[model samples]
Target: MASSRWIRPEVFPLFAAVGVAVGICGMQLVRNICTNPEVRVTKENRSAGVLDNFKEGENYAEHRFRKYVRNRTPQIMPSVNGFFSDPDLPTN
Candidate 1:
């Protein structure tokens, strides 16, 4: 003879309410994930618009890098031992 623990009748309504709440929340979560811009931008959605975005990003990065390089001043730091830049080398 085996005895199983049976759920109390009063707890059934609580379980039912929790289940309904969980179901509603789960459905909402699924809808959000499906509709999210990042999630929706999958490889399957590839098009000219995606390519244009990538090209624009590359152009912007390259433009910023070029502007930085053009505006920055170059300087060589001397080592503590002063061995990296040879003092023996004649300066123009």
Candidate 2:
């Protein structure tokens, strides 16, 4: 035959400790749910969107660098045959 006592004197403290721990955890869970605001996953908030914007800036930088290079390219040859040879070239 088994004893049907709910709280055995030897194990009552252990059961109480477990119950207290579970209650504390449950209270924290409820508190977090109530206090935390809802978060939405929008396109602007996504990492991929952020990275895309960075990539766009990188591309713009590259474009500006290429434009700078193009502007700096040496114009060794004159357009007209006697343009550079003539001393009377327009001051403009």
Task: Score every model by TM-score.
Answer: 0.36, 0.35
lDDT of 2 by residue, 1-92 (tens): 25656557888899999999999999867744543223225545443432335564555446644777686536656546448688787755
Let me know the TM-score candidate 1 reaches against the reference structure. Answer: 0.36
Q: Which regions of candidate 1 fall more than 4 Å away from where they truly are?
A: 1-6, 41-92
Alpha carbon lDDT of residue 79, candidate 2? 49
| Tens digits of per-residue lDDT for model 1, 1-92 | 22234476777899899999999999767855664333344557644243335664555446645877786555455443346557875545
Model 2 lDDT on a 0 to 1 scale: 0.60
Model 1 is weakest, by summed lDDT over 10 consecutive residues, at: 46-55
Scored by CA lDDT, what does every candidate get?
0.60, 0.60
Model 2: per-residue Cα lDDT at residue 17: 99
Q: Which residues of candidate 2, in runs, are more than 4 Å off?
A: 1-6, 38-92
